[model samples]
Target chain A: MGRAILLDKVNIPGIRAFEVYREHGGYKPAGKALLGMTPAQVQQEVIKSGLRGRGGAGFPTGLKWSFLDRKSDKPRYLVCNADESEPGTFKDRYLMEKLPHLLIEGLILSSYALGVKTCYIYIRGEFKYLVGILETAIHEAKKNNYLGEKILGTDFSLEIYVHPGAGAYICGEETALLESLEGKRGNPRIKPPFPAYKGLYDCPTVVNNVETLATVTSIISMGGDAYSKLGIGKSTGTKLMSACGNINKPGVYEIEMGLPVEDFIYSEEYCGGIKNDRMLKAVIPGGSSVPILPADLILNTAKGQPRLLTYESLAEGEFISGSMLGSGGFIVFDENACIVRNTWNLTRFYRHESCGQCSPCREGTGWMEKILYRIEHGQGRMSDIDLLVRIAKNIEGNTICPLGDAAAWPVASAIRHFRKEFEEHIK
Target chain B: MLKVTIDNILIEVEEGTTILQAARMIGGKVVPPAMCYYTSLKGSGGKCRSCLVKVAKGSAKDPRPIPKLVASCSTPVQDGMVVENTISAEVQEARKGVVEFLLINHPLDCPVCDQAGECDLQDLSYGFGMEETNTREPRREYPVVDIGPLIKLHMNRCIHCYRCVLAAEQLTKKRAHGMLYRGDTIEISTFIRTAIDSDFSGNMIDVCPVGALTDRSFRFKSRVWFLNPMDAHRECSHCSGKVAAWMFGNEIYRITGRKDTFGELEEFICNECRFEKKDISDWVIEGPRKIKRQSVISGNHYEQMKKGSIIHPIEGTTEPQE
Candidate 1:
């Protein structure tokens, strides 16, 4: 509802056009960079700002740009990871569905900065409708001379294509997404030959997440320094928190990164408090894959300090204890919700999504899901709880991608945080 | 290399190695029951729950706890580490539960399956299954599904092990199969029935630990124990990812995934290799036709007709003899 850099004029009557964006001092950064600054200088400015990826990982955006294998004579490529298929994450969907131009403008600037001639937005298959919306936006951008071949009379040329995924969740993983882009299966490739080093038909590439690329537009516009002042140390800027489940307002909201968790949960200014004034049973601060935190532990850090929403504060006392800030998929559990059922839901997702590439994840997730389902359905024994823990432990670090970890973490955390609820559900 | 011990047995393995991988390096070094494990899966997929072993703690009075099993499938090796694989009542109980759970819908129709000779469930059941059915009622039957044109389904026999789905996803770089439900109600289904078809379809039959997913081409042909396996990397009918086919009575009856230079079979097979296997297996060579010559059936009427049918009147076309 508020104005973040990306959504500044999204709801306005006349602001959805290039002319309107242009009037509001948009595309000036690209023009400035093209007309005045060099690509290297633009990268240096981004690096100086210390902006991190808005996608799940929170990787340093400037550092990601810096990792481009510049030594190659081959063309450099940029891929936008629009496959935002994580269960609780929907920020990118809102941004793309509402204000497609912001992403396109950011993409153009990013393309110019990285010397990328071709950019591809690899969106998840579920976003099939959005693909046409984005295509129309791309067509509109091209008509206005911002997308194809030499933007605003600059010698640099670029073309953007929208490629749809076939409903595989693993495509959200960067390496897997790259492989899919090359018309291969959506399995994650091994690291070291990471997409940054070698990717997209085996060329030098930079694959930035969708929200990560959208942030680039504002960085160039308001200047990275101004953007940096919005949040706390390192985790600067406004993060799009996708709050759902139990909250009165269950939707995507732009909030400063350092907002207090207590305030976010109870304040009228934010989610308008938990539903029906029910006692908050728990909160999955980041996304579903992160550990679930009990209400009290969520209110206080491990050292018994106030829990703020900065990545550092939220991440304090992690590892089988605290919750994760992954992908910003916040799920809230009120008293009415069943912890075992909710956990079963998340485990079911991981079990379903597991590519089965590795033995542990492929088999473990399925096994765990079945066990959790049993527990929730009143078919579990006393020992099933311990078995759930053991199964999750086996899957934690033993897979091709974080999807395994993503699947295992929630089960482990849910068990760790709500063992009583699980016991209660057990018949 | 980091030196480690399983029970009292000492072994050395590389750094960044899981206890499972270390055990794999030294034959019988430390037997961690790994159902779904390999070093390549980026160390995850801990499905089988069989590789449980005990580790050393600091006390002598009670050096070993009551439990003596840890899933060696994913635990990495460390210097001076110690582990024990003795069967504890708890480990056995856990193993039993997991086995019984996996067997809920598994059609133990081993006598009719092509994977019977080399099945993990059959092999692991002795050590894991208690010979007592957890459920008192009749075993469940999962409805058989037609996943694709090439691969056949025996969902009843499937233990719900997802090895095949992963193999197809990894090799094809496309997610062809996915587990659709959650918990005991969870079933493996494609997002839609339209087409789970892919080149890597045969690999599902390969990684399935039981008869849950049997090949339609070789469905009623022979039991797996009768087939002799030859490890020749036969070029896939379409892409690389050399598929290993089982030969029974001089006929290649079944195709399973083998470890390859690429990712796992399910995930790594090219679409062409995955889908075109059935056509390749069913190939027939046409004999040379002689327009002027005929078969040596020099008899009247019926014999002449048989000879005439054998030879084509047209030199290059397959036409009836005049």
Candidate 2:
């Protein structure tokens, strides 16, 4: 329904092959960036594009790149975050599986723009099959002069490597991924000396999401201003949303930023409305980390405004009545779905994924899971509801990383929107 | 210098000083309890959420307060920053919740635990925890693993502070044991059946906040309250010989690294200083009068220590010469 950018040539036959991909305008932008644009000029265009990170946090890509300590003589590095372990989020995996060359082309261009000599794609361990696919794509790209030393006959040389994680969901976190990249345990580092200043091997580094890097190709292809103009406001360009649960068409869909939530869900071209014509109960518009919104809230805001898929629109009410467009992992639930059970499932995921670093996340997630499990299994007291809220409040914002907040938001939002369901489960 | 008002008391500290350090510097009613932070170890902060504090105003460098409560142990104080520890009801409640969660899986076998007198978790729970536990669900249980002849790991009591892990890697540059599983079922275990035979292996007992890792030599030898501790040192080729000798009557039972008033190790003693140097003749032991305060043991032990009930060595025997 929207102008397709990432998925346009994704379904084309032999797109995974470098020859077919180069024939269909794959490495042209990378060639242009390497030959024509200065690294600073490329960074400036990215700043002008206003492309926010597709990696849940929505940080501006150019702003993140600008923070790199350029004066430091340490070798700079670029890490493409392919650890797509977020629940209901498989868009990156699909992008790599189908259009691996696009990601490679984007990685080369990004590496050149950042003045990085080496780049690593830290993919999730469960995506072991994609590692082979990506390695093959890398070999093909290098053979075609799209990657490796002296790419496109330019002075800029970059070597991209595929590093696999040991199936830890916490590795999806950027700092934890960096730690894992160094062959250490996947524990997140503290901020202030952020990754830009001191990252891989204590050097200046930039870690971009797979989708975020892939979009760089388009930004360079059509000038940044043109790409910025495609989407509304600060949320520029197209986004790949992986839709699942109770939907007839449950797959990744790339749409322009300001698509209305209603059309995206009910329209035949998108999710094709709820399955079997059942009433929508709730929707986690983002990944599991963001707040879950009720059907009414997901459709429109508390201010009676139509909720758009853009970052600003979806997050209009903040945590009170609004949810974020985090990772663009859209999950839907029909009226038959139980919020308590759903919340329990998500809490269990978070508890399992917690790296056991921070006390609030490490201990609180386990407590919440056990409590939610007890309540769902009909052995909870009425006080357990208040206790759950109290525990979630204590956990949010108290840990070393966002994992604490990630573990807390779903439980709190579930209780906020579906209190009656939880209450009923208690009786 | 950065001026911060913690609990309405203004204090100035050097830049890049964390709120926990500032609170400790001021030394009043506002000292935040941290379980995982070891001042000597790099990258030791941020793991434990027990030191959560409210910052009303942020520093000049970072103008906005973090959206949520920040760990005082990791958050550096900015110029003109305002922080609240015990004064904030929210922070108190949050700390209480953290203490509760920590105790959820803790076997609470303090009666049998050897580290009862000096355990940081026991002290923190008494200071910040509620009277009763709300969860009726079964607590997590783990089979205790004897790490070696030096340390016994009762993982169920562990809060997963990572101090021992950091001590192993940072102090010894070797890892014998690491976190094995994920999430609630997580446990610290050695890779194979190999013993943690590093020279710094015994320091794991000192770094553990709970009774998870106990000294095998000192196990059931004597209650900590009954032992009289004296600061002692010896000329050794391995490392700094500064240590604390815990004596039962005139016989030395165990030796550990000496700790300052803040309960931080003055120096991370080696296994030789910790285990092999248990004899009284190994080093010159100081007088027992230096033992001013002991970590709280039970209900009445604090009162007993306050009344100076510790037995001093008789006359000239204090100078034990090799």
**Best candidate, lDDT-wise?**
2
Q: Interface RMSD, all models, one decimal each? A: 7.1, 1.4
Encode model 2's per-residue lDDT on A1-427: one tens digit a residue: 4889888898789888888888998788887888898998888888888999998999999999989899999999999999998899989999999999889888887887789999999998899999999999999988888777887788888899999998888988888889999998898887767999889999999999999999988888888899899888999999999999998899999999999999999998999999999999999999888999999999999999999999999999889999999999999999999999999999999999998876778878989999999999999889999989998988887777788888899999999999999999999
Over the stretch B66-167, how does candidate 2's per-residue lDDT look in tens digits? Answer: 567888898888898989888899889888888988888888899999988788888888898788888777899887676788898888899998888888
Residue-level lDDT of model 1, residues B164-185, one tens digit each, is 6666666565777776653344
| Chain A TM value for model 1 | 0.96
Cα lDDT, all candidates:
0.69, 0.86
Worst 10 residues of 2 chain B by lDDT: B299-308
Model 1 DockQ reads 0.06
- In order of listing, the candidates' clash counts read 47, 0
Q: What C-alpha lDDT does candidate 1 achieve relative to the native structure? A: 0.69
lDDT of 1 by residue, A1-427 (tens): 2347667766766565666767877677778877787888777767866778877778899988988988888888999999998888899999888878888888988888899999999999999999988998888879988878877788889999999998878888888899889987576765545677789888889988888788888788778778887788988887888999899988888877788888888888678889998988889888888888988888888788878877788788877456657778888888888888888888888777776555456666777777887887778888888877876775565455788778888888888888888888885
The numbered model that scores best in TM-score is: 2
